[model samples]
Structure formats: C-alpha cells, structure tokens
Target: MASDPFDRPNRNSSSFILVGVPSLETSPICLGILFCSGYIITLVGNGGVLLVIGLDNSLRDPVHCFLGMLAVIDVVMVTTIVPKMLSVFWLNSTQISYMACFVQMFLVHSTTSEESGVLLAMAVDRYVAICHPLRYQAILNRQTIAQIGLAIVVRALLFMDPLTGMVTKLPYCHSHVVPHSYCEHMAIAKLACANPRPSGLYSVAGSSLIVGMDMAFIAVSYGMILKTVLGKKSCWKAFSTCGCHICVILLFYVPGIVSIYAQQFGSGISVHAQVLLADLYLTLPTVLNPIVYSMRTKQIRQAVLKMLFSRKVHA
Candidate 1:
C-alpha cells in the first residue's frame, strides 16, 4: 500500500512530499517524458546561445550581454525544479528534505525576480539604441552593464531572502504534502500549522513591488522608443531590432502573470490546472527564448550557423 504522506510524524525535519499535478497522477510516465523533453530543449537552446555568444566576439554588446544573462537565469530556473519534478514522476520519489525545499523555493523565486530585472534592463537597452542611437554606446558601456547585472542580483537576493526566511520560521505541523511539483513559496507556506499570513503578505507585496516596478519601467522605456521612432524613415529598421526582445518579454511575463493570479485568487480553479499553468509559466520561456531570438535576430542566426558549420568542418 502507498503510505499516506500525512502518516509520517509531524516534525520540522520531516521531508515534504511533492504531489505534483494530481490531474496527471495516472500519467506519470507521460508527464515525466514531457518534462524531460522540455528540459532538454531548454538546455540546448539556452546553452547554444551562451556558446555562440562566447565564441563570437562580434556578438558582444549590451543587448547580447542581457540575453546571455537571461539565458543563464532561464537555465537555472528550469534546472532547479525540473530534475526533482522528473524524480517525482519517474521514480515516485516525491520526498524533498526540509532544507532542500527552502533552497529550491528561494532559488526559484530569486531567479524569477532577477529575470524580470534583466528584461527591464533589456527594454532600456532597446530604448537607448532606438531613441538615442549615438549615445547608446556611451549609456550602456561595459561598466554600466556590469553594474546593472549586479543590481539585479542584489535586488533579488535582498527581497527574496526575507520572504524565504519568513516561511522557514513558520511551524509546519499541518501537512507537508505540497500540491505542486517543487517547492513554491505559498504551497510550502500553506503547509504550516501557524498562520502563514505574514509570509503570504510579504510574498505578494514583494513580488508586486518588484514585478510591477519592472513592468512599469519597461513600458515607459518602450513608450519613449516608440515616440522617438514614430516618424523616422528608419522606423521599420528600429522596430525590427526590438521585435525579438518584445516577443521574449511577452513569452516570459504573460503566462507568468496569469499563473500567479490564477494561483492566488482563482478560487474555482482546479489544482491540476493551476499546477500545469505554473509549470508552463516557468518552462515555456526558457525553451522558447533562444528559438525566438535565433529566428528573429539575424546576427544570432548567422553566428549560430557559423559556429555549427565550423564544428562540422572540424569533425
């Protein structure tokens, strides 16, 4: 007989069982296959971008710098959860140590916040390139890019640490069976015997403050870029340069916001649906961002082709 997770002793040291998507319970093999495939695509796609960027000197610029950062974050974001998710599906190994759960929770949330910051930075890069083309080099120099990257990391760590800390301090005597695949903040928090309101409130507030501010800044940056390029003869060219970034932004944010809101307020939403949405929110962008960039950006396409052909010749 499959033992009930609740049958385990209620101790802070007890491992949490990640139930994964209850709707997909009967299809664990299928789900595992899907996750495995997505993880491969994410690794190959993002890893290809990073490789091409490293090999091609001409690809080094402010925009590519941010793309590289985004790819790194995407790889981390998916890797943090997908392996454990696969274990749950394939081996029925749903148990996650208490410390490991908190670590996963922190990494997932921090990487997400950092990705948002990178997107905002990319938006500013586009705005500068389009609106002040001459000053673009001056504004987004190597030093400035480094500083921006540092700021993004620092901000995520600062905000997410407190949220994770708040959750860790909560007493978890209620239940340790997390409904979703991996350790999401609220899912873990809801397991606590004590009131999780403070942690929940901090999560909502912190996410809103960071994501909302990043979205607002990105919007304003794009607005100015549009205003500057509206009547110019080079308008089409400028728009083309930003098209890939815009698509990447939408891919990352749209599903994410939907999943987050649906999880938070959609009372009637099924756990299966919510879990699927969350999985998509995390995995989709990582898999698609490199493909979109390769298709849309001529330089990346050319560089990638060049790298592949060179390797082929060597082989």
Candidate 2:
C-alpha cells in the first residue's frame, strides 16, 4: 500500500505540522515565563495609557489626543504579534497553516503601518501646536483627529493587502519551519517554492513608502518645532513638551532602521541573533512608551495616581 504524504514523516506535504527543523535552544518553561511577563507588562502599560487618556478630561487636548491614538496603535501592534509568538514558543511548534500564517502576517503589517501613521499624525499635531500656535485650536479639531485615525486604519489595511495576497498565492513545498517565533513576511517568503522576488520587492517598496514618508514628515515637523522652541523664551517648557515625544521617536526609529539594514545587507549576524533583535524591536516600545509618557507628563502621572487611589477606596 502506498503511504500518504501526511503519514510519512517530513514528506514535504501540506501537513498542519511543519516538521524537520531543529528546535530553538531556549527551554519552554523559561520562554513561557519571559513571554508571559512581556505580555502582562505590555498590556498593563498600554491599558494604563488608554485609561489615563480616556478618564482625564484635561488630556483631551490635541497633542494628547494624538498620543492616546499612538498608545492604542501600540496596543494593537503588541497584541497582534506577542500572544501568537508566545504560543509558538511554549507549544514548541513552528507549524502554522498557510492561511493562518498569512492572517498573522497581515495583522502584524497592518498594525505596524498604523503605528507609523499615528506617529506621523502626532508629529503633525505637535507641529501645529508649537509652530502654528495661533491656529492650533482651529486647525486640530476633534473631527480632524477622528479623520486622521480613520485614515491611518484604512491606509494600513490597504498597504498590507497586496503582501497578504502575494504570500497566500505562493506554493509551500513542505519546508514550513518558521525560524522566528512569529510568521514574519520575509521569513515565509524565503520558504516559498516559487520565486518570491516580486513579493520581496513589493514588501521593500511598501516599507520604504510607509517608513520613509513617516520619517520625512516627522523630521520636517521637528525641524520647525526646534526652530520655534529655540526662538521662545520658555526653552525649558518647550523642551519638556517635546521630550517624551523625542524619546519615543528615537526608540521607534533607531531599531527599525537597524533591522532594515540587518535584514537587507548585513551578513555577519546569525539568523537567531537577528530574530532576538527583532523581538526586542517589537517589545521595547510597548514596554517603554507608557513609562515615558507617565514619567514625563505630570498630568498623566497625577491622573493615574488619582485613578489608582479611587479604585482602592472603592475596593
């Protein structure tokens, strides 16, 4: 009797379990602990950011309005990737159905693009507030913010749709072991039987369009912010307003640029090392963003403390 491909071990069939790969070095127990800790911290921190913004009426201004959106985007970004990654780690299974993998990839890319758009919106908000103070209130109304948010969501969805289609069309010839914890687009593209050059090019071009445009807008906004701040007499106040944003901008951009270069050009680093770095890039912003805003923004800090106290008293 002839054996089914699924019955044979590592037969390069469309089995749900992508087999024939060496397991990662980390113990499942240790990986589980770390992953859980990261997830909890990310959730708590981003949740706090949302709560503080929503409850504190004073933070409903244009600048914080954008900050709140940024926090929401971060929450989506972390939630999309981290939980699935933890499952992959703890279960010790690198297997994902082609459809499931494409979905995950789509969500990750969508959230990432949304985040970039939010950052760009925030920078524009800052520019209006600082550089065009006379027209700030008139220009950055609630309706405008709502429109920006909608635009971000729509743009992210559209930008990622092409890559998702490309990935799903590619033939998977049984070598489905994803080296990373998550179903990264590039990693999956590498495993396809057909030439993924077109997908690769599209991915790179999309990244350039999104990241490049965002960075350029942020740069121009900050340039005007810098000029306005330096021209003002209250230098300290101006610096304080922009300080948290500056930290977040650096946190978001530096790792992103490095990862792009590493993936595209660097050869000295191992894939495992690159994977670890990518994990860091994914996690650090979620962990640090709330801390930056809470510690730096006195209003948010006081609001958080008041909310905690109120909760305790109610309890």
Candidate 3:
C-alpha cells in the first residue's frame, strides 16, 4: 500500500503537481497569507504606476514611456506565477496542465528576457539623455520607442522558441511533482526522464547570450556616461538621472546572480533555501521596480500624487 502510494503518477501524465513550499506544506495558512499579500502589493503598485503614467501627458517623455512598458512587464511577470502560487496555498490546487506549465515557463522566461532588454534600453535612453542632450529629442522619438518595444518582443521570441522546443521534447519518466511554487524552466527540467544536463546547459547559454550581453551593453553605456560627465554639475546631473535605474538594475540582477552561484557552486544548502532564493530573484524585481521608480523619480512621485489628489477631489 505504501509503495502504491508512491507509485508513478504515470509516464504519460498530462499534468504535474507543483508542490508549493513542501517544507512548509503543513503551514499552508502562513504561506497563503504571505504570497497573497505579495500578489496584491505587486498588482496595486505596478497598476498605479501605469495609471499615473497614462494620465499625465507631461510624463509622455521617452523615459516615462519606457517605465510604463516596464510596469506592464512586471505585472505580466508577477501574474504568471503569483496567482498560481496563491492557489497552491489557498485552494491546495497545484495541478498545472502540461501545456499550461510550458506556457507559464515560456511566459516567465520570455518576460524576464524582455525586462532585462528593457532595462538595457532604459540605460541607452539615459546614455543618450546625458551624453547627447541636444539630440535626445530627435534620437528617442515616439517612433524609436515603438521600434524598441518591437525589438524586445522579437528578441524574446527568438530566444524562447529553441529552448521551449527542447523542453517539449523532454520525457518525464520520474515523479510529476515539481518541488517549487511555480513552473520555472530549471525546476521543470529537473523532473525530465532523460538527462537534464542539456536543459541546464541551454539555459546557461541563453543567459549568456541575452542577460550577459545586456549587462555588457549597460556597463559600456554607463562607462561612457561617467567619462562625459566631466565636472561637478555634470556629474551630479548624470548620476541623478541614473540613480533610479541603477537601483532597479541592481535589484533585478543581484538576487539571481547570487542564487545561481549559491545553487550551483556553493555547498550543502537546503532545497528550501534555493527555492526561496529563486522566489526572491523573480518576485523582488517585479514588486520593487515600481516602488523604486516612484520613490526615486520626482516626476513620477508628483504625477502619482496629482492623480491621487484629483481622484480624491472628484470623490
């Protein structure tokens, strides 16, 4: 009877059970509260940013437009995982259909790539604003923003197609229980019946090709900005312009970098710790980007305040 309980769900199972925080599975109430709170906060914070940006024409500048794009990405990125996570805790419903799991995996990675590319685009925008102040208008017009958005979509598609195809080919002969709150690529890959090494290698290669390249570009852009800002006034202005972005970049990248090293290179860490790190890697950026921008950027703060006050007045 015990053996039967542990038997394979089936080699051809049409879905996988996401074992959300198995170590804390006994305390579903606590986990449910925590994840649901994070979900609400993310939706409200990001949604507010988008609303304020839309309402304020003064914020229709290229920078704010890019910020609006980022807000949308954050909302999508968080939506792909958090709601399901909440379900795991609240309803104890963790069974994600096979195709739906892949779609979630695809959306998570694709949106992550888009966010990284968007950050790089924002860095370029700042570089132009600081280094070529006079030509900023001509260079980063509405047409250029549209082109950048289109390019981001194309980049995400190009990267995800091969990776998703490879993952789709994987045979899941082992347990169908994924030991995480979500259907992340690496987590799902770990369950495959065949060798998972190729999937890991492909992920590393994709990261190098996408995130690594974007980081290099951002570094180069910042380096040039530093050189161009020669004097005190210029230095202050340049740094001021980049302050919010730098915080966002660090918040977005640092967790994943640390977690990767900790998981693959570091020794003797528990699985729960690794899962927590992964959660932070994705969740922190989505939750914090809007908060960081609203707090650090005066124009955004003022716009949000104005919108709030206007609503209150109408009420």
lDDT of 2 by residue, 110-170 (tens): 8778878887887888789777889998999989888988999999988888888888898
Steric overlap count per candidate? 0, 0, 0
Clashing pairs in 3: none
Candidate 1 C-alpha lDDT tens digits along 1-315: 877644664576568889989767889999999989999999999998898889899998898999899999999999999999999999989899999999999999999999999989988987888778899999999999999999999999999888988999988876678889989888888888888878887777788788789989998998788789888997787676566667767777776676666665556778888788778878887888777654466788899888889989999
Alpha-carbon deviation at 21 in model 1, angstroms:
0.7
* Candidate 1 Cα misplacement greater than 4 A, ranges: 1-3, 6-9, 231-244
lDDT of 2 at 297: 68
Error of 3 at 178 (Å): 0.6
Per-residue lDDT tens digits of candidate 3, residues 83-201? 89888888989899999999999998899889999989988987898889999999999999999999999999998998898888999888888888888777787788787777677
Q: Which wins on lDDT, candidate 1 or candidate 2? A: 1
Best by TM-score: 1
* Model 3 global lDDT (CA atoms, 0 to 1): 0.82
Better candidate by lDDT, 1 or 3: 1
Model 3 residue 151 distance off true place after TM-score fit, in angstroms: 1.2
Q: Using lDDT as the measure, which candidate wins?
A: 1
lDDT of each: 0.85, 0.74, 0.82
After aligning candidate 3 to the native by TM-score, how far in Å is the CA of 295 from where it should be? 4.2
